[model samples]
Target: MPEADSSTTPAIVLDGVSKAFGANVVLDEVSLTVRQRSIMVMLGPSGTGKSVLLRCLVGLLRPDKGRVMVFGEDVASLDAGVAKDRRQLFRIRRRFGMLFQDGALFDDMTVGENVAFPMRMHTSMSAAEIRASVDDKLRRVGLPKATSKFPSELSGGMRKRVAFARAIALEPDIVLCDEPSSGLDPVMAATLDELILELHKTLGMTFVVITHDTAEARTIADTIGLLSRGKLVTYGPTDEVLRSNHPALRQFFARSTEGPIQVL
Candidate 1:
C-alpha cells in the first residue's frame, strides 16, 4: 500500500488501545487522533489514564490490545526486546521530547547545562553550538538571566521554565507535556500556557498536553479530549467540547462531583 503524505498524516493515532496492570484496567479501548502541528489537551479527573496514555505513545508502557501509530509507523508492533526492533523504537522515540510532571531538573547542574543535557547526550554538536542554542532556548522561556544558577537556586516556576528549555533542545517533532501546570500558582500556570503557545507557533511541533486544569485546556488547546476511566468520553475542537452539554464534560468544567463521573 502506498503511504499517505507525511504532511497530511496525523501525528498520532491510537485504535482500540487498552492497558491493564493485572486486574486493574488503566486504558479501556481508548482511541483518538492528534493532528500534526496542533495542540491537543487531554483533560480528566485525577487517575484517569491521562499519564499512561503519554507513556504508551513513547513506548515506556505497552498496550495489551490495539495499534498505536506514530507518523505512519505502528509502534505497538515493534518489540523493544529484539535488537533490530529496539533500534527502530529508538528512532521513533527520537521524534519525541517529554516534559515530566515534576520538572525533573538535575539539582547540581547549572541552568545552561541542564538545557544542554539532551543535546550533549543525543547529538554530536560542538560545545559552542550547544552553548548558543542553550542561550536562545532560555531566552525563549524568559529565563536568560538564570543561566549560571542551579535548580536549587531557582524558584519552582523558573526551574520548570529551564526544564521546558531542555525539552525543546533537540527540536523534536512531537512534544509531550505531562501536567505542565501541576504545581504552580494560577499566574505562573497561565504564563506557561503562553509559553506553550509561543513555542508551538515558532517550533511547529505537535503537542499533547496532559492537564487537569480546565482553564489551561481552554486557554491552549486546539483540540480537547476528556478521558474517564480510560475511555474517551468527549473529543472535538476546543470550542465544541467546551459547548458540549454531556454530563461528564459539564461536570468536569463546573467542578461538580455529582454526575456521570463518580467521585470515589
Candidate 2:
C-alpha cells in the first residue's frame, strides 16, 4: 500500500474478504469501509460471523481470500521471515485497542493493574508515568477510585468500563469493541453507549462496535453494516439501512419471525 491522503482514505477497509472453518463459511466476499473518526456498528444475528469479521480487522484471524487493510497497510501481507512477520503484526496491532466481550479482564489483577497492563507491555514509561496514566484513564471512565478493586468486586457495567479504560490506555487510532453492551441491563447498556459516544467525541478516534442490538446500533452508528449468513446484507447510513426492503434486513430490524431470516 502506497502512502495516500488520510482525508480521502478510510481508516479500515475490507475487500472481497472471506473466511471459513472447514465446511462452515463464516464470512464470504464481505467488503466494507470504515471512515476515519466515525463509529461504524456491525449488527447481525447470532452465528452470523460478526466476531469473525472483527478478528479479521485486527489480524487475529487471516481471511481465506481478499485483503484487510488498516491505515493503508494490507494486514494479510506478511514477510516470509518469522521475525519480520512478527514485527509487522505488532505494528498493525499497536494501532488498535480491543475491548472484548465480557470485559476479558484478568481475574488476578486489580482494576488499576488491568488498565496499566497494556502500557506496561507496550511502552517504556516509568512507574510514575504508568500510575498517572492509570489514574487518568480510570478517572476518564468515571471510576476514579476503582484502582484497588478486583474484577470480581466490580459490577458488570463497571467491569466493562474498566475494559474501556484499558482499551484506550495506549491511545490507539482505532478502538474495536466486541459487543460492548452485551450482558447488561437496558439502563446499563444505554449508559455504555453514552460513554462510547462521549469517548469518541472527546478522543476523536474511530470505533467499530459489533452488536445484535438494533437500538444500540442506531444510538452509536454513523454507518451500519448488517451481516447475515456470511454476507453483508446491507451497508449504509443507519436510517437508510433501517428503511431497506431487503427481506433479511427487514426480518432483522423488525425482529419478525415470518421472514427470510429463519430462526433455527
Candidate 3:
C-alpha cells in the first residue's frame, strides 16, 4: 500500500457523538470534522455541550454513544482505568493542549514557571532547554518581559496570554481554547483573536476554540460550528455557515431573543 497521507486525515472527527448526565442530554449526536492546520470555532450558548465536547476530546469524559476520533484513534474507546488504554490515551492527550476558560494559571508561580510547568512534567528536555523554550513561548504570546511577573501582577488579558503560552509550551499538534475571550473587554478579546491567528499562521497547529462570542469566531475560525441543546445546529466553512439561512445561526448573530434557541 502507498504511504498514508497525513494531509487527508483530519485533526479531529466527532461522529454521531452523544453524552448525557442522568436525564440531561448535553450532546446529542453531534458530528463534526476539524481539519489540520485550521482553526475551528464552536459557538454555543451557556449550558450547551461545547465544554463537554472538549472534555470528550481529551478523554476527561467518554461519549454515551458514538466515536471521538483524534488523529485517527478513537478516544471515546479509551479507559483511563485500564493500563494499556491509559498508556495509549496518555500519548493521545500529549498531542493536545488546553486553555481553560478562566486562564487557569497558578497564582504562586511566575509567568516563566507557569509556562515551563508542562515541559517539566512531560518532557525530558534539559533545564536550560526548558528555560529557553519558556522564553520563546512567552515571546510568541507577546509577553517577553513577563517571565518574572506573578499572575497577580498582570491584567486579565496578560494572564490569558500567559495561559495560552503554557498551552502551547509542548508545541502540541492541537490546542483547545475554552472561552479564550471570557472576562475581557471587546478590545482585549479581539487582541486574543489576533494572537490566535498569528500563532496558527506561524506555528501551523490546529486550533479548536469553544465560545459564545460570534465576533471572535468570525475573526479566527475558518470552520465554524454551533452547538445548542446538545445538538450541532450548523457547521461548515465560516462564510458558508454564516451566510446560510439557519435559524440558530441567525438568532445568534442577530442577538435576537425570539428563536429556536431557548434562553435558559
Q: Please give the CA lDDT of all the candidate structures.
A: 0.90, 0.87, 0.91
Per-candidate TM equals: 0.95, 0.93, 0.95
Q: Per-prediction count of colliding residue pairs? A: 0, 0, 0
lDDT tens digits, residue span 9-81, model 2: 7889899999999999999999989888899999788888988898888888889999988978888675435
Candidate 1 regions exceeding 4 Å error are 1-5
> Of the pair 2 and 3, which is ahead by lDDT?
3
Per-residue lDDT tens digits for candidate 1, residues 1-264, read: 335337888999999999998998999999889999999999888888888899899888889999999998888888999999899899989899889878999988999999999999999999999999999999988898999999999988788888888888899999999988877788888888998898789889889999989899989999999999889999889988887777898998889988989876
Candidate 2: RMSD to truth: 2.0
